[model samples]
Target: MPFKRPLLSSHTTDDSESQSDSSHGGPSKRRRVSSPRNIEKDKTVLVYILQAKIDPEMMSELAMLVENYKVERGNESLEGPTSVSELNLELTGDVEKADVIVTATNMRQRLERHVEWRIAKTKAIVTPLWLQDSVKSGRPVPYGSYIAVHHLEDETSRSHDTVQDASSGSPSNMPSEAEKQSCWQTEPTELIDTTEVELLSHTAKYSCLRPSPLVCPNQSLVKEIDVIRQGRNVEGEERSMLSYSRAISVIKAYPHVITKHNIRDLHELPFLGVKILSMIEEFLKTGQITEAQRMLADPRFQSLSAFITIHGIGPHTARRLYDLGLRTLEELERYYEVKPGVSDEETMPLLDAEASANTEAAGEQSIKIGLALRHDLGQTIPRDEVEEINGTIMRELGHIQKGCKSVIAGGYRRGKPQSNDVDIVITHTDWNLGSQKVKGLCRKLVQRLHEQGLVTHVMHLSGFHEHNVLRTHHWDSLEKALTVFVSRHNSSRQNVYRRVDLIFTAPEVFWTAVVGWTGSTMFERDLRLWAKQQKGMKFDSSGISRRHDSKLYHPRTERDVFKVLGLVYIHPTLRNADA
Candidate 1:
């Protein structure tokens, strides 16, 4: 026979009419009225429980406790009944409209999949213990102690063991037990194998030797390291920044999902130091890096990062501005203006008058223009806008000279949805033209664009004269102009300034220039590194040269360049080495 549960009821109140009838001493009548306990039930704290991995008996008890629970308000009002708080706890179904979510420790990742979990920043996600304790104590407890961590079976350990067993036949294929032990000094549960996993087919050291896609499986970990890398760059720690960048590139190129079980694969890669490895382990354990979080929350670092984004502002200038007590772009703008009776010593105590004067004279106009149009220039250029801009440039180029070809490089060619700037490489099929002809074509294109109200400002123009060409040694010495551009047909009805770089290359190195300009920085860096170290060739945007004899090799196509370097041609979309 099944047992029947008893129903709980609140105290009833007597109606005023019933009291008046009893006072009249006639045949008295009684009526029931709603009580404060029933009124308190109207206002409830909604809690949704994720039942995975929780004991059935415990869950049953929790449901009963929640149904009978009342949050004690403590005797603040000594003269009246204490305020009552009721619980509207649910053990099953969706978490919509829930103020709190209680789940098992191992179910954090599952809880994160809920849309409400991410959108509601104030919603509390706690362990079952929090709810149990809250009911026992008659109030919601502090969430700090109950934030969940995974306590399920360690899949990483099982996967690592499987790979180790599979590679046992070839001892040299696996890292020695001592090396694996040394990689992590914590308890056995925290140990991470520092050798390459057999499951991963590729373990190349150079980024050019592997494929790195834009969507990385380890993006969360990559983001934390990038934050720290940016902080180092802003602080002018070049060595540290390069270290983080190398680690980032390696991580991005890694094809497998990064987990504690397979983290040892990163150890096989070059450029990742013990510090970076420790941070990776920390993130896998806690979903955050302490150093990265601290830097993100630092006010001074925030100010410096903002300043570095301004045109013509580098790390040193950003630091100097910070030293002068300037914490924002507006403050820096005010400082740049000429003020009467404001001596250099009074305004910039950190620098001498001569140094201040030299800094002011250098790039003053560029800085002023950058500040004036910061908002317009800072907006990202969508793919459609980039295409429209490219069309405009092509039209102007056709008017200036016939039979010219062009390609939009940079992130656009790499298939990015949006880009910070537009880089266009133009060249003619005719190879008989002299270098002066190419320079003249570039000059005419800029002039035409300016006359058409497209080129609003010219930040730089190079390689147009013989002296400028002789002064530079690289292929980047191609005729080029960096200008601020605005389309005459802006559908947004606003003057949106865009940074446009126009590079005019000779027909011989046009493909090479395209490859150079369309790059993820690490991919290009590794390509050059591979050429110099392995092929004994110097590679750049201009062309590749045999370092042994200074003989130049002109690759007519992008594939020819890769073939000469002995690298598998990677599509631009797969060249995202997140440096």
Candidate 2:
């Protein structure tokens, strides 16, 4: 029996079922939330729960679509289970606050019976997996309607640092219809009325792209960190100045930074904020922050990241796991598995198992990879060498086509000067002869580099066709000559464990392409919101388009893209993830 959740805002519903459950030892109580807006007045609620693997590589891009869509409609979209006992406690109350309910059909068997909706009309949008289940059950998903879409892949282009467009539109507040479609549009495929249950594997375009690990303990941390580094340039200034990256210098040493002083003294230190203070204090007393503690106890992280940390799981995914109620990798391993491989069903806390297994696996992978590549990609290669390799790759392609233009984006373009991977965006007048031919060009280039003994363990991707909107690809072995990954020593002298992403775009969306690829994802997200909320347009890493009419848009330059979005151009450094 589930409990009822309190959602006292726009609508109301009775939860006698939860009350009954509570009378039998539960925590079901009625309460309400005061929201500033009453979006439930006469609209529907669409709740998307990711029940499958989520490709982190595409997270920033998907966020663009979600955030932009909401702004375009001036609507409020709420998520989070808010509580367990969800059906008896929360759902009944939450649904009453809306005129309609829309959920991904994936949980048809798992959640449908647990949380029953009695509304006259309920809508279910089936993904490929959900569709298969529906067909197997001989069900029509008797709801408002079912729409199956490849949400992540349809138009996942990179975002520019600022304004994200500037490919075909002028610096104005409004983007023409043409500009809108260039960014996003529906590409309907054959009806997914399949009756098969065969498992299909999917991959994100940039599944190999990963988050940077935390600051190294062996290395000194940055000091002279500028506080409030970025702000809108007053009329006297341009767009908000970007955040400071490289610290001027560590002029002072603060000892035992964590325990040297209390929150008060820490506040007096450079760059410490209330939030950061809380995190530090929590860690000092209990050896962890609330989030970290919660994360450690969750099953997913314990099983996944904790163990996967050996493979470089970052803070972003750790938090996402915590949010999913998985406190440890152990829990993740033991809990809700779509595939039944691990068998330890004694029903202990779900997250603990995940954490243990995750830790063990991470340790093993680290030992294996570190030993293999210790002599190779050990210390950072000279920035010059990193650039030289990329330059060589691009120049080789250019030799294949005289006027082809190739740009290295991602952290390299962001001025990291040092990076774990290299991403190249190409465009040319003869698109087919130049950019469109990158897949073959990359193979020849990498093979040639290998023959010269200047290239080591390598992976290359072309035509990254994304399948499922949720979990996509594990790019480790999905490339040309992936066997190089087996190297015991990842040497960067010539080419040690290097990840490269190559993408080709039409000349029409060339600028958009550049903007999308040249991004601090955070800055890109902000610019996208600016366009949708202020300019009545949808902005993505791929293209800019009209919101009302759902049209494609293009801007020729980065400045024009921002101008059209009613914003000044933002620099890459200013794009902080926390922002």
lDDT of each: 0.64, 0.37
**All models, RMSD in angstroms:** 27.1, 27.5
**Backbone clash pairs in model 1 (N, Cα, C under 3 Å; residues 3+ apart or in different chains), count:** 1
Error of 1 at 479 (Å): 0.8
- What is candidate 1's TM-score against the reference? 0.60
lDDT of 2: 0.37
Write the residue-wise lDDT of candidate 2 on 168-191 in tens digits. 122323433333322222111232
Q: How much is 200 displaced in model 2, in angstroms? A: 46
In candidate 2, position 321 carries an lDDT of 54
Instruction: Provide TM-scores for the models.
Output: 0.60, 0.36
Q: TM-score of the candidate numbered 2?
A: 0.36
Highest TM-score: which candidate? 1
Q: In candidate 1, which residue ranges exceed 4 Å CA deviation? A: 1-202, 338-362, 434-436, 464-477
